[model samples]
Target: MDFEAMAEYLPLYKDAALLTLGIGWAGIAGAVVIGLAVALIVHFRIPVARQICRAYVELFRNTPLLIQLFFFYFGLPRFGFSISPEFCGAFGLALHGGAYMAESFRSGFESVDRIQRETSLALGLTPMQAVRYVILPQAVTLAFPSLVANVIFLLKETSVFSAISLMDLMFVTKDLMGLYYRTTECLVMLVLFYLVILVPVSLAGSAIERRLRYGSFGN
Candidate 1:
């Protein structure tokens, strides 16, 4: 292992890691918004909109993120819709992650006891009020763990951003390996950088899940 080569490449990898995190988190934020909106529509069984959201969830969940990125970055140009690589990366992640997030939230919403909704309505609360005051709180709590897992999954998926020509951590690592033939050093840095990003998130998620579980038990 060439320690000098690894050290020399550190700055580039740092920048790329930041870029990856920025785009990944931005995509995750977008996914949360899209997922929440879709889940609400599905929960309410909002006529045509519910069907449309269902179709969207199935379409995105079944397809590969790379294909989605390619469509956004390359295929769109044929139709004169040229977007930046950054936009493609973030947008594709959002669309892909949104599908899974929607499912997670929808399942959480449905898991709430039907009796609670009925009771809220019997107490003269409007449908939206019932959701806001009764259903949403418990559903969000139920969904928090799944949301954390999805965020981590989406962050890892950012490695595919290289396919769209983004200079993410994976891209920089591969570029350095090819240029300097420092495969061991580059791979080591890649693993280290990823662990640096993911380990804390995993640990934090576990901690939060434990707390939520305990809270649920009224301890």
Candidate 2:
């Protein structure tokens, strides 16, 4: 715990931390979009669409994220599908993280009651209408907690992008640690950086859940 060692690394530490947050934020945003789309496909139980969605979820969820990152970063180039490291990293993160997210949302949908659905159908709603108006609203409420956890996980998982040279916070931190020899100081800050993003996300999720619950009670 050499304070001076950390002081020596302060500037580099700041740079690396910023990079990590930037990369993580971008990757998480992409994951949220892809994940929600995948989740919806599964939730609706579309014929071929559901199967394809299931296949994607199974394929990505079962494998190591690092392997997927390598596949996107290295293997794709062999097929003339070249992309930047950041692009590859983000693609891999979204695809992989989205798999789990699909499951979380699907489970939430499954948790929805049969009566709510029946009531919606009785109200002259089509299947899509029932889902969009009746089922999905409650499902999202149930899924909110799990989704928030997954978002935090996905954000933390963004660190893996550094392996492919994404220059995210973790990548920057590593470089800073090497340069300034303040491993403790920089890492502590890095942890704080992660919490900075994750904590607010968690709070936002809670707020949304509260609103949903309020709506549910017709209050």
Candidate 3:
């Protein structure tokens, strides 16, 4: 399997891995914040804001992520803004994946009891206050599993960034394979590399779900 030849490509693999994580983590952090904010707006029926959020979700969700990436990377330059491919790629993920994440979070908000909303009204809490105090906390627990799943999905999506010369994992791997002709080894290790990140994330999500179930403030 040309194991010795593949081992010589360690530096290339390391660079790819670091770049992948940097972009993936940054994009995910943004997506989480934006997704939750949009989800809350829709879940609580926030007048014009709700409709705007719905429109955003539909627009992004209905579109292919690659097209979004291409638009940001290829098309935006026409507007006289010089953005790095990394920035375009990350922004695309934050915008596109944020839509799906919003839906996941919205489902969590749906699981909240109607009485909770009524009780907040009875207690003179503003709609914002109810969402801030009561709904978000529960929604986070419900949404945590799907959130973790999305993280893995987004991490893999960074592979697409390679198309824009982002030099992420898949890009470097492809280069290494082409240079050394160690396709099988490189591809197999790439699969393992992805799993190395994703498997722990899966385990952590499961652990959090169990804790949420058994610990204080049960859903």
Candidate 4:
């Protein structure tokens, strides 16, 4: 194992790790927006919109994320639209993550009591206001653990961006290995870097779950 070679490349790997996290965070934010919208549509039984959301969730969830990224980065350019690799990667991650997130949000929405919505309506709140003020808050708390899990999964999946030359942590690691012929050292470093990021995130998720379960956040 060429530990010295790995040490020499540490700074570059650190930068790449940050880039990976940035992409993952952006994707997760986008996923939350998309997921909330889809979940709301289904929750309200919004006729055609609900069906469209269901189709979207099914399509993205059933397909491999790599193919989805390729379609955005490679296939779309074949037509007229051309987006940068970074944008394509982040957008692909968002769309794919959104599908799974939609399911989680849907389950969360279902867990909220129907009476809350009725109470909101009785208080003369508009449907939108009721959803915003009453139902979504509870739903979010219920779904948070699953949402955290999904975010972490998406973070790990960002490794796929390496195939499209995104220069993420995995990409940098691969480059380092190729340049120095230190596969074992590079792979070990890669695992350690990912663990450093993901372990804390998993721990934080658990803490959040506990707090929510115990009403520590005041429900």
Error of 4 at 7 (Å): 1.2
TM-score of every prediction relative to native: 0.95, 0.85, 0.92, 0.94
Candidate 4 collision pairs = none
Which parts of model 2 have CA positions greater than 4 angstroms off? 1-18, 214-219
2 or 4: which has the higher lDDT?
4
> What lDDT does model 3 reach?
0.83
Best lDDT among the predictions, by candidate number? 1
TM-score of 4: 0.94
**Colliding pairs, model 1:** none
lDDT of 3 at 23: 78
Give model 1's TM-score versus the native structure.
Answer: 0.95
Q: Each candidate: what lDDT? A: 0.92, 0.79, 0.83, 0.90
Model 2 earns a TM-score of 0.85
Residues 112-195 of candidate 1: C-alpha lDDT, one tens digit per residue: 999999999999999999999999988988998889999999999999999989999999988988888888899999999999
Cand. 2 Cα-lDDT: 0.79
Off by over 4 Å in 3: 216-219
Model 4 lDDT at residue 148: 92
Worst 10 residues of 1 by lDDT: 210-219
Clashing pairs in 2: 19-169, 20-168, 20-169
Assess the local accuracy of residue 68 in candidate 3 as a C-alpha lDDT between 0 and 100. Answer: 88
> How far out, in Å, is residue 179 in model 3?
2.0
Ranking by lDDT: 1, 4, 3, 2
Per-residue lDDT of candidate 3, residues 160-180 (tens digit): 888888887788778877887
